[model samples]
Target: MAKINKRRKRIFNMLKSHPQGLNGEAISQQLGVSSRTIRSDIKALQDALGQYNIRIFSSPTKGYRFSQFEHLSSIEHELFKDNMSNLETSKQRINYILYKLLANTLNDISITQNDLAEEMYISLSTLKIHLNEVKNILKKYDLRVTQYKTKGIKISGEETKLRYCIVDIKNIHLENEFFQDLIMNIDTDLLDDIIKKVLSERKLQLTDRSQKKLCMYIAIAMQRSRNNKTVVYPSSLTNKIENTFEYNVAKEIIENIYNQLNVDLSCSEVYYITQCLLASKKLIDVSESINKKRVKNLVNIILKEIHEKLSIDFTNDEYLIDGLTLHLNIALTRIQFQMNIRNELLETIKNDYPLAFQMGVIAGKIVEQYDNIKINENEIGYIALHFGAALSRNGIKENIQAKNIIIVCSSGLGISVLLKAKVEEYFHNRLNVVKVLPGYEVNEKTLENIDYILSTVPLKNIASDKIIKINRMLQKEDVENIENKIFHKKDTDLMEITTFFN
Candidate 1:
């Protein structure tokens, strides 16, 4: 028997459990050590394991996992028992439960609820609540939870829906608070980097959130493919997606991931990834989409339907038009592929914003009528979130005293268009953006009637308090600055916003 260093023992345990591997970033976070120190430790551990057949393989993408293993369990007592992070939040626990149940189903294995609860370090009573939440989420994908006498609970569904369910669940990512456990047993960072680079090269667009989601799907698809489980689309549907741009993008992404992870996904995986892209909230120029007659007509119909049904007028609201045009195009793809996500915020939206939800239902029905397909509660809830924003915008117009504002951007055209739109859309007549001027163009007359000069760079000779510096892309704090400094929105009326639609 050889004496092992304390740090090397812990690293060995993490490598043993994480079959897929962890990047230096993830491993360092888990171990509370510097990446430089981790690199040294991995080297020392590799030398120690040389006598055994175990070898550590590193990839630029996947970090490190064992490349070879034999009789490694013989040294198990020399290492710490477990390196998995404890499930703390309800978010983390439910995500963990979903992964275990789904992974077990794919592997054709079963364990009792007692066994699972023990494995997760949770009480059986507590597990029931988490399991119930998981069951409700599964229902959205036509997946049902099944219990067995000896084997614990398992998800029962079509192969395709099961994979979609996994994809829809964004693995519990708690940043610095979590380690080795939150990723549903796989590192998504590698996949995310692969997908991000692919999309950038191809010039396709996805929001940051959507890109993370696509990575989640790819990670799950790769794991399941390893388990010999795969998504099967109808040949006609598959053929249709195969010819699309998203399919080409998926092919490239998967090829890159294959090179990194050494996992060759079934061809159907490519088509499924294409469907994920279509169902994703695609970011595109509103001006470009509004010209499409179908999207324009659909937006018009949705706006008219909401107005007629709710007596709220938004027919000419360009923000709403832009929002719906972008959303409905993706909704149409989601509907086509039957890709539905259980919106975690759906219940909150319905309870807190009834009128907004009603508007969403109305909008959903219009989409259904336009395409002759039913929109699920999940989709309706998403539509409602946007409607809720519009309602809030409409409500605040009356209460908040409108302020004149100027935006100063150097070269002001491209970036200012987006910033100006975001400010106008969010403030919605509360802060009137009087003009966008370059720093060189900021004269006294340009500053007249302007309450705040929202600028990317500080203008010389301008009063510091009067000029609010903002990112080229409007960020959370930038919005907060405008809200607190310009509008004094915290002191603004709350009554109209809560009671207006009622």
Candidate 2:
């Protein structure tokens, strides 16, 4: 399994670099794996990348290119439904549970060894072994498990390290086929009600459209909870409500039950719960009646928990916070649209981290939009491809060196020294600095072959071509502006024109 994972990572990297994808035969040779194994690996990569709006395609001439990255922003708006179909196996469910458990424990500071054991219903020895294994897995990324008696057990590491651990664990768990089968069998309705209640108690509103969406999201979450991949949506509600208002209210109640009690209901399980919410929504406009303070508290709790537990800090940027609050209110407007609640938050995310967030949102949206679509990690590979492409297009340009120029300043010290430091900081990699020429020792040879001149003191009767004026004192902004001008210059020749005072 480790070997397979390594091969997958290598193949992913190779594909990312070679956007016009590599052939299976080439991949096999590169990884030293059999063609059969490469074929399977390709399929897995495709499924993983699907969520990111990346698709791998084979062609006679071009070989392969992740064709989706260019339009991932648009493509990710719709869910990839194809990937949803294969998630029904039993092994998939186990993997899902394992990942969720690990993610939850790693994120939560309140969770301890005993708490994990009890929650998992495993013996202490088994729990310890499992945690040890998890720790071993985390060690690869320089992340460590620190068991604190006061703070509880927590995974301590940098943000990037934590992300790697989470993504790896989730990927491995989702690859289980048995859990996928089990997920396919779980009832969606019961799961939906449970999710709705959780949202409502958290003060997140769902419109009619969102209510259904939330139900689906919950179904997915529940399926994930059970270590399964597929969720079964029910055809009809068991207890039908007379009025729409009443039904919406009842939906809230069912959602509440699921949130408070971990007893998730299948569509069959929460048929009545759906009816009640629908009826309540029709009869009473509970939107106005909801306590504002309570809602605020709920949102805070959810966001705080997600941040602390997941180590996924959705930084409280002003725009992001405002956007989340706006979306939360919009979701509360109608219980039916509750599931669509996160859409606005996602939109806000796009605004903040235009590249990465947009990519993630688009990938998620594509999966939500399409049913039965299988996307894999190759989609992320494609995003990386596009990112690289963008960088290549817009990043720094190299200049052809006319002559190697060396800079000299007074005494290698003092305010003239500070000027030297600024010049070095700005042009260290781009230009070569030889030695500092003090005022008394300065000679014509020092200026002899120098292509350009930078000086704090005025030089008399020196080579006219070698003289350029520089400020005696350099400011912070001066350094920044100079670097920016050099790095972003459209004309390459201007790169060598180092006029310090200007």
Candidate 3:
């Protein structure tokens, strides 16, 4: 049970990041394993981690995550953190190649296959094999590898897609931690200030994340502009947004950028920047569309459907409705225009906020059915945030049923009283510390009708699921184990609680 493979170690970290949970197919895809292999790995993980109170929770479709507990200390952190960071796997190499190609494309640089293979310390044949996987991934972003074998390889895609793919790769591979420095020769600090000032003037409000993303997009724009890789918007696309408030804001932003960098940005950039603003989860839209009624209806339908599917009524949640309405309306425009904004936290949301992410997935399907357009995971992650917030706001408390428990403390009465106090304080009304008994008094007559026996010391011949052997001080693992065993979420309310002691 103590033994674990490197793959399972990666699985542990992946599950940690994705508290929502991941399905077998998803986990298998990330780890490059089969569903059968994943099943065995999960079983092994459950057995290995059970000692540490790291319970693996798995719903039929919601996926797998650490059940209720958030922290899992990796056993190999000191031994493998350094080795883990290096590009050891084929997946890592593919990611490296993707980044190199995109980075080169961003700066209009080129490198031959020979040099690329040499730099990575991989053979030409191995690099070629990895390139096949790299090409498949790029195809999803509407990007292609170009000029191979002759003038060296470059990423051939729309300017916006290039930027999107650059961010997308970082999210797909957690080890790709260097995307923040993708901006070069530009003062992002000054750019941030300018964006804030322009946004204030326009009375536009953005989340901190949105603002940061805009800064990066604008920086890329500046760098790309200098390289003559300017994005061009079609007349039809330009016509739709050219006169909007966001357009005006984007125009003001570029004007400030020009003043800061002394480089003239193309007219298309104004629309490009506006698209970024529209694609994000904004606090205020520059202009509210006349189709606001339709968006409200969609939000209502989504909440109603979620209630039906999850049996949680969010129809009366005005905050959730309003948030979804605004988000979906912009999402419609984003999908229609193919804006493809990056969601940095999609994997985390999908794994960690499993229920909410499933809700988002459900909501996304409804929108897809309505608009006849497919929504990506990034968009669904944004939708999940709304549901996740609603879940938190309305969750109020864990639905706990009162349980009968006897604290079998071999220590003195004071120590037993202290353990009882800790149990009462931590668990509140969830558990009943019926009586504190010495080890001698823990036999059948006292154990009769006792739902659980919490002991500081080991108890012999008592191997029931209800037996909780805890630390003397009730450490985190002890608390977690007790919680997992006794604190069940039932449909009953606090008012309906009936304790054995009472």
Candidate 4:
């Protein structure tokens, strides 16, 4: 099981309060995290709940709720189980060691075996065991760990590969004590204020998650610079970056950091930091500088591959072409700078849109061919979102059943029958009106296969969510409202991408 965090607990508590439940946006409001994070947390919580005879029920309309409230106490305990003990787990320790090694390498700090063991609260023998696991992880990234009796241990690899490995470490280990320690050492609030001020002054807006990531990249860069591990940007790239507004803004941000932290960074370090800033923020138009022939060929090949392999044609999608070209150009910039591109919606995109993700993988292969840089799953997910949006625009529909609705009316058979027919005429295959019954006749057993109840009369004992009151003769506005509910609804299982492959 994944480590349960405070956000997940708060989310569960909030959902527990509203048995009728809350949507992603509503839950996001109650908790200050983004909807994306809430969606991710919901999936993790769902997986964790299965063992407790509890389940997180979700739908486009209902958001999420626990299936069995009787198991709440047990579920809560399980979420908090092994809280302090989690750090001692072999997998957690391995992640911690990997994070320490990568972060120290970037900061050019060597860690002695004894110090490492002490930091991990493990004996030398146990530390060695975890070190072996760390080595295997490093090997996957084509990196090697070097240890010496005098100098301790450090990781070494190609510069770009090293950055990529650090990105991987950050993704896996950000919640651990090691990363928390790194954050605690810096005045992150001051850094955040300055970053916001600078971005506002420059009129460059980033989403909450993007802004958070930008601050993290800056913090990492600052930590490395403090340890005398300076970044050296290639001269060609440096010259190009120096001419951009992003580079200037990076300089300003660095200057603010120096003022706040009393640290000086080398010009190359500034240039490198500038690239990191640009990586997480919106891309400035590089249409004039991008290779038109290369991007055009890449798009044509991607569309062709999707057409031949999946029988999906998007040849006439000029808007797709324009949008994709811009995205590819930005992607190339990130590759050139060896910057990590994170897509928080990656899991959702992959889960909800399998064919789009497959097409994205094919496109990613073409991207890999054009540039030697291997695209990560996160980047591929972003590409998939583009294709998914394109598919939605072109009216390519998925035959997903929205719900199994039970209709209830207090009126006689004629009125109930008319209501059912109206609903069926409107919703069609999107929903199944499984049963029609008088309101007084309805009970818990009748709701067995039902997603929810559509009632002409108000339900007394039934949960608010179990019955949705509607007119016997539905108005045009009611039809539109139901249409919105059926069409724009997101699947409750936010982790549909992983589910698809599994």
Cα lDDT computed for each candidate against the true fold: 0.70, 0.44, 0.73, 0.69
> Model 1 clash pairs?
111-152
What lDDT score goes with residue 28 in model 4?
Answer: 87
Q: 292-386 in candidate 3: lDDT tens per residue?
A: 79889988888889889889999988867876787777788878667876665578767767998999999999988987899988888778877
* lDDT, candidate 4, 400-480, per-residue tens: 565888876543222344456567656756777776654544677777767778876776676755566787556677676
Q: Model 2 over residues 318-410: C-alpha lDDT tens digits?
A: 322332333233233223222111122233323433554343334333433332334333222222222222222232233345334443443
Tell me the TM-score of each prediction against the true structure.
0.58, 0.21, 0.56, 0.55
What are the clashing pairs of model 3? 18-351, 18-352, 19-351, 19-352, 20-351, 20-352, 20-353, 20-354, 21-351
CA displacement after TM-score superposition, residue 405 of candidate 1 (Å) = 12
| TM-score top scorer | 1
Residues 165-242 of candidate 1 have per-residue lDDT tens digits of 655553443342322232455557777778877877886756444666777777777777777888767888887677
Regions of candidate 1 where Cα sits further than 4 Å from its true position: 1-80, 83-99, 112-141, 147-153, 167-187, 285-292, 310-313, 344-355, 385-422, 425-480, 483-502
Evaluated against the true structure, the overall lDDT of model 3 is 0.73
